[model samples]
Target: MDVLLERKSVRNYTNEDVKQEDLEYILRAAMSAPTARNTRCYSFLVIKNKETHKKIAQIHRAAQMILEAPLAILVVGDEDKAYEKYLPQDCAAATQNILLAATAKGYGSVWCGIYSNEERAKAIEKLFDLPTNIKAFSIVVIGKSTDNRPPKNGWDPEKTKYEKWK
Candidate 1:
């Protein structure tokens, strides 16, 4: 619960590299997310090269922070492995798992969306040369954070409803 509350989107990061074991742990957590009909449609691309990060930052305007992070993980969805139209949901769950796991590991992270944006998605696909069956979903940039902002309490009674919309 503490981890949940403490998980904040960290954009400013130091140049320290994330460990291989820690990356593996985060990927494990991502794969552990529930998928629709047991169809795990997610694939991950770990970007360690500064050049690749710069290219990604160009592709995603909000991802300029990627330039500072030591690494970024691109979460993609494989249509061939997905069940119906649940790829987005499955990938989202996996992305959330990545963020939570990174937080738990004492690392800072941020999620950058790409799936629904046609232009951005196409650019990313071209940049990575992804197969037609695979689609870009999200990129999670991670590193040792330089920002010290506190976590926000996102709970809002106005946004909650019980059992019915009315």
Candidate 2:
């Protein structure tokens, strides 16, 4: 629980490179997250090449982190096992788990939304030459944090409603 609470979006990072073991452990934790109907239809693309990461940054205007962060995790849904329509949402959940796990490991992370717009999606797909069904919904930037802030809570109670079916 402490890990969950301590998790936060970190932008500024240190010069240290993320350990391969740490990266694998976090990815494993992310894969452990439950999926709808046990779809288990997810794929991950780790962008460590400077050139590739830079290209991803170009797709996201407010994503300068891609250039600084040592790693960019491209979370995609494998359509071969996933149903249509729910593909993106399922992939997003998996992506969130990765971000949270990275935070728990004392690493800084940020999520870049890539599937919010058709143009952006098309650009990413073409860049990677991904199939039609496999969708890149989110890109997570992970690295060692140079600065730390207090943990945040996103408990929007007013935004949620109970059983008052109208």
TM-score of each: 0.96, 0.88
What C-alpha lDDT do the candidate models reach, one value each? 0.95, 0.82
Task: For candidate 2, give the lDDT.
Answer: 0.82
Off by over 4 Å in 2: 155-166
lDDT per residue as tens, model 1, 1-166: 4789999999999999999999999999999999999999999999999999999988899999999999999999999989999999999999999999999899999999999999999999999999999999999999999889899889899899999999
- Model 1: which residue pairs collide? none
Please write out the lDDT profile of model 2 over residues 1-166, one tens digit for every residue: 5777777777887657888888998799768867778887888988888899888878778678878888888888877787656777788888889988888777989888887778988898889999987877888899998765776887787877788743
Number of clashes recorded per candidate: 0, 0
Candidate 2 steric clashes? 0
Show model 1 residue runs off by greater than 4 Å: 164-166
Q: For residue 127, what is the lDDT in candidate 1?
A: 100
Sequence-dependent TM-score of model 1: 0.96
* Shift of residue 87 alpha carbon in model 2, Å: 1.1
